[model samples]
Target: MTVGLVVVSHSAQLAAGVVELASQMAHDVALVAAGGMDDGSVGTSLDRIMAALDEADSGDGVVVLADLGSAVMTAEAAIEFLDRPAAACLADAPLVEGSVAAAVEAQGGADQAAVLHAAETAWSPAGSASPPGPSGPKAGGGAPAPLTSVFTLVNPLGLHARPAAALASELGALDVEIDVNGVDAQSVMMLMTLGAGQGAELHVSASGPEAQQALDVVRRAVESGFGES
Candidate 1:
């Protein structure tokens, strides 16, 4: 059906990574990323996504996949902002691979609803579930690195600027490759892009030799919601 596809995440790199995998599986896919960028201003990036969607919609309806609920909600709202149909699909997978595949399948004539449903099935609930990382002793001699950790944004203000900045700082202090699953575009800019509110769910991950220590720090920061008071 030549559906135009959109991929939303906390970081552009994460989105790129997932879509890359999907492209290998499928061809001629449209991958538009929205969220924070390294240069600053996720809002600007969101606008870019909106513009691309507008063009893509003119050809065939677009199927959108988001890394998290908040990103999906934001994309939904963004459609409204652009006066476009709120008919985009949402891939709620905790990782980029699942989400991108869902979007690709949707664009390739699969039912958008069904594809997104499948993606959601891959996501972990925000309870006591541990992240998807190695569970062995890590480089820092602590617990094995967790590639993924989820937490509820229980703070009243959600993840505000200070908290997000603090979270960024914490990530900066780690020694692993950090990424947000649901929100793939989660560079420091992606943190600002999602504008996650209270009661939101977040997933973070770190890989490499320092995965364990990085995972611990990320989980702690997530639990703290970046030191929110």
Candidate 2:
């Protein structure tokens, strides 16, 4: 099962728009928008946040991303009111970046903790190293060899939001440690920070069970211009 996400913002449009953008790369993950008041004015509402939390949950836990201070407070209040507070968490991250990152991880079938970490770490610099490698070697100590490939982003717009999301979503599913030009391939924010133009080369490296598969997928997507004509 995949974790779900909630976007809490002061503006209805902002919250809904963020969900729409994130959903492009995470279609299967549940994303609920809780924004504005009952009358559609600009404000956070406890009832709305509570309802969104309930609707976003689907057996799997939920991670909440809020835009402003009051929105965060409202989310916390909603969680505190929950009989099972552990089922949800308020991620301290920028609304747009955090929502997109969280959505990508959730789409990859990550559990609640992983999803929360993904969102919380969206603010980290793109060039920074990943959280850390798995505790130890595999049972047989026969870890897969590192698979590497280099491809130039050919799309006219380069690796923009949509393309970044596409690449991140696909790579996120693989059991691999992938880096595109030194940035986490599974992080949309980090990928976007590349500012990779049309002719920029992407150095992809991974070492895990599906390392080669992940490399191939990225190669095909880049070569195909990510389906953009």
Candidate 3:
């Protein structure tokens, strides 16, 4: 089973809304909302959080995202109460963005560590280490250029949330380092920040063993308008 996600918020509606937003990009991922009190008050509840942790987890681990400090404490406590505490962990990240990023990564089959990284890194910064130089020399004793592609977004929404998640999730699984118009291609938040709209041009480049395959994935998503238009 894929990694699951739990959104802990003081308001029930807030948690549910975040789950709704994340689910759009991660249809297959288990997303649970643990918010408010069972009595319907606007407050954090350990029991609620514990129940959500159990429900969200399948076999793979679960990652928790909280809205506020106390919610985080509650989440931590809930995780500790689990049968196998290591099966769940809390993420220090923004509630909405982290949930979405984590959900998409999990949906893409990323392991717990990678999925947690995705959430923790969400909206924190837009940077990636430069890939190490080419592994080996070419027949002519020179390294090849990175695979590149250019696509005009035909989708009505351009690089919106769902499409950005699609790109980040699908591309993040590859061994390649990719850049789309100079932004980290594996970051959903960074891609959305591009403000690219319909008809905008995307210059994509990739390096590493899966460079060509990574380019193909982006090409298909962009050319097909992310299956939107």
Provide C-alpha RMSD values for all models, in order. 15.1, 3.2, 3.2
lDDT of 2 by residue, 1-229 (tens): 6798999999999999999999987989999999999998999999999999999999899999999888989999999998899989999999998999899889878899988988888879653535555334542577655678889988898999888887887887887888889888878889999999899999988878799899899989999998997
Candidate 3 per-residue lDDT, tens place, 107-213, comes to: 99988988898888887645542223333344246556778889899988999998898788888888887889988899887898899999999999887789999
The candidate, 1 or 2, that scores higher on TM-score is: 2
Tell me the TM-score of each prediction against the true structure. 0.43, 0.86, 0.90
lDDT computed for candidate 3: 0.87
Candidate 1 residue spans exceeding 4 A from truth: 38-44, 68-70, 122-229
In order, candidate lDDTs are: 0.56, 0.88, 0.87
Query: Which residue pairs in model 3 clash with each other?
Result: none
Number of the top TM-score candidate: 3
Report how far residue 19 has shifted in candidate 3, in Å: 0.6
